[model samples]
Target chain A: MIIQREAVLLFAGLAVVLAVATAIGWTLKRFLAEGAPHPTIDNLNARINAWWVMVVVIGLGAALGRTALVVLFALVSFFALREFLTLAPTRRGDHLALSFAFFFVLPVQYYLVAIEWYGLFAIFVPVYVFLALPILAALRSDITRFLERTAVVQWGVMISVYCISHVPALLMLQIPRYEGRSLLLVLFLLAVVQASDVLQYVCGKLFGRRKVAPQLSPSKTLAGLVGGAASAIALGAALGRLTPFGVVGAAGIAAVIVAMGFLGGLVMSAIKRDLGVKDWGAMIEGHGGMLDRLDSVCFAAPVFFHLTRYFYT
Target chain B: MRLLPQLLGKAVTGLMRLLTGAQARWVGCGPAPTQRIYFANHTSHGDFVLIWTCLPPSLRAMTRPVAGADYWLAGGLRRYLITNVLNGVLIDRDKATRTRDPIEVILAALGEGWSLIVFPEGTRNVGAELLPFRSGIYHVARQRPEVELVPVWIDNLNRVLPKGDVLPVPLLCSATFGTPTRLREGEGKDAFLARLCRAILALRPA
Candidate 1:
């Protein structure tokens, strides 16, 4: 009987989510019709298509609720971490540290989030694993580039472990109306953050004139920044009901997400440039790595988490 | 089963192009060439795959890779892939005498108009220096003097997938197809092998 009720509720929820996506997609189509160029229109259409698929998955998973969604987030963290380490250089001595990072630390961090052990999830990588992995490396006694090697191991843990695990850390939030909606919060953050990236690329291609940071990211532009951020803010505001935020409050939150997302893109782009690589790693089709997709997530996850925890909690 | 190998071939080729920027180009002209021997230096596991992947689809159908029967036979997955899908000619290197010639099998493949890839170096080596030819390739070449001897120099493959490493790291590679040479009149076996090795070494990028 409860299963039937849950099934009906899931069906209804999916229908509503798809309905909203379709409505927004059509609205964006109409908006594109006014002044957007042909290629921009086509690219935005492609993004919308991808967005629909992402939404369908997220919506269905959310309908199933907390545990399933956390598993999905954990998978994302694993893939992202895998990509991170795959691109990062390692030596014979660092093999143990690398193995531990990928196999042990990644699961432990996500498991903490899964059990709603917020305190440990927050510091497992930074505190315990962070200190421990280096000691494991130090014991090797085959120390070549001891400092540099340790730093790379430490940085891999920081970027892949600490930053990425923050996404699932959303589950610990305890808002009154949004008590069971932390999964929704994660979905909202990912959608808006990723959408802004796609929109900015489209906008920049169509109307980009002044390069935002030519040296760092030649493709980025100020026009893309304004247009993409504005669109993200609007999308965030419209989807405000997913959170405890109202229209104005949502816009403010959206602004923060857009800002951080842009910074995240910049930082990741810079990291790629430093590595003398075009992409982080070949994990995503036509895109680079796990970090390539989650560049914004890395920044946006923690920012959104703290903002919501401060105000809504 | 065939579809999976073909798909895997495409994926691996695509990956090689992406990682190493190594491109394969077939040279020389021939008409349904049969009983031919392709001899090159052995550097990485990719040596066979790279050569196999580079061959024309039509030609790939009948070609057999001479893999160590020991290594390929031991691993279950490797055995299936090599013996069945890859259609490799696995031979026992350790238990074999001069009479137990793998080249005879390659010669049989040639008699059936199937091309064969053989590594002159019996083992994988990292250095640029070509190891002494095992005389098996020479024996094959001598037996089939009519067959076109394609000298394939696989450069930087040692760096791409180095010795004792399981995972392949991307490094720029090139497979140079040098002019075909045959055993000259009255060319001694030792002198002939030396000349063939030098021809392969000459194909290295200056």
Candidate 2:
């Protein structure tokens, strides 16, 4: 009974999001017909199209139950980690460490989450993989930039795999009353984070004047941050029944996610600047790559997971 | 039987893309079915495979990698891959006297309307720097003057799978194909080789 109710809710929610996206896309198309189409508008349309596909995939995964959902997110983690490590400069000495990170560490991390092995999942990458990767590099005997190379690969695994895994790990939360509806928590987190991102982009395009960090991210603006966060907070409050958090609690948590999401984009932008690449990869049409789409989720996942685990569960 | 090689090609292609995240950029000229020599920098064992897999499927069928006879023919899986899967042109790199001219073998492959992928450095370098050309490229160009010589600069391959590494790290690599060059009349061997080297080097990402 609970599963049927959840499935209906998931589909209905997806339909609403899709309808809104189509309307926005239609309006943008009409607007684009009027003028010499702006690059930002084209990019906006592309992102909206990508969002429709993402929503369909997620909705389908949610309908299929836990295993599919976990597998879907695991694939996302794989792509995100691939994007992250591709840009970061790693030497030959780090090859074994990286092979292990991709082949061994990432899968193991996701497996732990799937099996609900919380203790190992939390520290596998951070503690064991982190120490082991440097030692692997050291074994190659290439001491030049040893510490820097090791740290970069370790950080990539931590952020892309370990942190992103927590998003799906929401499914395993053993809340007293929550029971089978834990997937709702995952949906709530994704909804708030992605909503914040989209709203921020829309706001920035319309009212952006003062850049937040010109050096790091020219697209980010103070106006967009405030307006987007406020809108997302309202949205989260409105959808509060979906999660264990009530209206006020949901709003507060949404604000935290928004702030972290903003910071996540900034930090990733900084890393891109350091690497001297505009986008992470060219996989997602106009959205850059998987990492670009998930930067916020990567940062917010662990925080939201821990918060929900502590407070609600 | 035919399906096996096709599946193997695709699997190898997928693996190369997954491991290196290789992006193929035809900067100067778009991919065409014309006979051409894709000369690139050799950095790892995976260099030829990376370049080979990056080609469009239509072009990939007609292209063969020029590999070292000593290494690719060492037997077992390497031999099977080079002979059956890739249809690679193996040349003796060490014994210039005992073996037939590697250039003749490549030229014969070219004569059959097949394109060839050659590493002008002749050997893989451990560092990022491009090693000096080994005269094989110049000789090929002189013989097949009409054949386009496309310079491909493969970046980050050294770091992905350097010398003596059995496994490859999943790193982003790119193969930038520059404007095709040909051997000029009255050009000295040294001068032509230098020019060819410069063309490949120019395609490196800033």
Candidate 3:
């Protein structure tokens, strides 16, 4: 088979789950909410519909081989960066530098990852872009809020570009007995993390009583986090065939991914609060924005990449 | 054939939407195809482009951006973009050199059933508030009281691609299309322009 059997199984499993979810969402909308509008049900259905599109796109990328997957992620990084920077406060002085970040720095980082130039991809944004862009901003000579501008541009590149690139960088890992199956690592990380997110939302909507952090995210609860992480850990253990890790090892890493993904959500929520906006933009119908979808992955990808590189590679 | 220019036009408009998001919030009105004079505050040169980009394709084809002949006809690329791609109406801003009255030219476009996107501020205002609207808008409204006057507020464009900048910072800009206003029965020139300016300002994102 051109694609791994496990990957094909994962795709089929996702399609069936989404189909059932769509059915349930439709039944709930049709029967439960006869008079008053149901916000939660409508939101769930919209999310599920969007998930169908996303799953198909990712599945296609996985089937098309590594270059296609890398290119797909490159476009994801582009949209994610756009959403992050759109809400971020910037000045006219930052135009040239900002252009460099978008046009030059973003593509170069992805290119380095595609070519597996690990030495440069790891530090391109953190070292070179961090050092150089501020110089360009400084040259414009608008010193009002200079420090904030510099920090934000650097942070956007880091979170949106550098960190998100780590997902594709997983393909560059040299693990024994994992030849021609590196795509599965990405599939595994995505499945575990995203399942954790969905589980958290479902658990929160149903059994959640105690708020995890009422101020950071109103929707999250302690019950949601605990229930979701436990389920995702079980899921990861079951999918051990996809990874170099055994069931226990996969379960441990799933725990780490869930924790990091939770932190990533909180941090991004705090940023939205600071920006005084709901969601990043109207890019996505119900999911808020690209950044909203990728926030968990942004925080989890780098740690997962490094962990796999250190322990298994 | 002008096929290349038309294709380039689509690509450039798409690029503009991609950069600024050019989201049209039809708060006070729907995006119905009607003969309306869409007026907005002038900040950057991209103001009308953003407004034009926000229109529905049905309205976009009939919408003509009102620009100054002095600028659009200044050179090669700008002239080509303004004429072929945007299909803009070049008004003679200079009273001294213009043979045709700017209001007549605008009314002519309206007579031909084309909607016009006009920046009523006469010139770009880089300050905190809008400049006093040029009386040309009031004249257009007076002449064509039948045509609806939609006040559009283009937010954050100056911050995105302000004057003297070639590349934009890719900020999220929105064009808030307020309820269509018309010159009242007894409204004077200054009063009508003031009402229009206030309407545009009211739509600014809080």
- Model 3 DockQ class: medium
Q: Rate the local accuracy (lDDT) of all candidates.
A: 0.72, 0.86, 0.89
The residue ranges of model 1 lying beyond 4 angstroms of the native Cα positions read: A1-60, B1-65, B72-88, B95-99, B107-206
Task: Judge the docking of candidate 1 as incorrect, acceptable, medium or high.
Answer: incorrect
TM-score of chain A of 1: 0.83
* Full-model lDDT, candidate 2: 0.86
After best superposition, candidate 1 residue B35: deviation in angstroms? Answer: 12
lDDT, candidate 3, A236-273, per-residue tens: 99998688998889999988998999999999999998
Q: Residue B82 lDDT in model 3?
A: 93
**Any runs in candidate 2 off by more than 4 Å, and if so which?**
A1-38, B96-99
Displacement of residue A204 (Cα, Å) in model 1 is 1.9
B1-206: candidate 3 lDDT, tens digit per residue: 37898798788889888788788899999998988989998899898889888987778889999999999999999999999989999999888888999999999999999999999889989998999888998888888999999989888888777888777766778899999989999999989888998999999888
* Fnat for each predicted structure, in order: 0.00, 0.82, 0.65
User: Candidate 2 chain A — worst ten consecutive residues by lDDT sum?
Assistant: A32-41
Listed for every candidate in order, the interface RMSD values in angstroms are 6.7, 1.5, 1.7
Candidate number that wins on lDDT, 1 or 3: 3
